[model samples]
Target: MKIYSFRKEEGKKITKYDSNFIMSRIIQSEKPVHVGCMHLEKNGVIGYHQAVVPQLLLIMNGEGLVRGERDEYIKVQSGDAVFWEKDEWHETKTDLGLTAIVIESEELNPDSFMALRIN
Candidate 1:
């Protein structure tokens, strides 16, 4: 699993036509993709499983702990994105709650768009 950032602080500032906004590019894929919003209540869990395709989970609200093949959980919150390669083992659970946008596809290349999370 890899952690990335989509926080406004890491986005490119848009100054076109006197517009004021920061655009955090998420993904650009020629291949098909699946996008969905996930809501997990307090102490909710998404059981461990192999990703059928590459997956990107963008934390939009709340926080959680995520684990990959190594079984080490990492804390993640809003604006944080987690990428898991196809067929990689992974799991996600939250002690409080979490709301995220999940994008999945066989051609995901998050590294090409988003930056790795900076400690």
Candidate 2:
């Protein structure tokens, strides 16, 4: 068993990100799942990118805009959750700043379980 506290963890500034952002890795294991928290300052942006694995972003505070491969963008606020499939291009930005928790995994194959269980 493991316990993690965002408040206790030190945030590392992501220098590679196109925009100003800080991230705190909460849980990283060989189990295939990774969890972290991202903080974006006002008017900050996380430039276009794609995840190698499936990802879930849960908005924790403030509001922001999310854009996918399409030209359209969606507004997201606290409590909102977003999912992105592997290699799906996406980006995020905010005028009022934002904080979110992110969960990602490469081993999210539901088909493997379905194959084992005859349903």
Steric clashes per prediction:
0, 0
Q: In candidate 2, which residue ranges exceed 4 Å CA deviation?
A: 1-31, 108-119
Cα-based TM-score, every candidate: 0.95, 0.64
How close to the true structure is residue 85 of candidate 2, measured as C-alpha lDDT? Answer: 73
For 81-101, candidate 1 gives per-residue lDDT tens digits of: 999989999999999999999
TM-score of decoy 2: 0.64
lDDT of model 1, residue 48: 97
Estimate every model's Cα lDDT from 0 to 1.
Answer: 0.94, 0.66
Q: Worst 10-residue stretch by lDDT in candidate 2?
A: 110-119
Q: What is the lDDT of residue 114 in candidate 1?
A: 90
Each candidate: RMSD? 1.4, 13.0
For residue 5, model 1's alpha carbon misses the true position, in angstroms, by 0.6
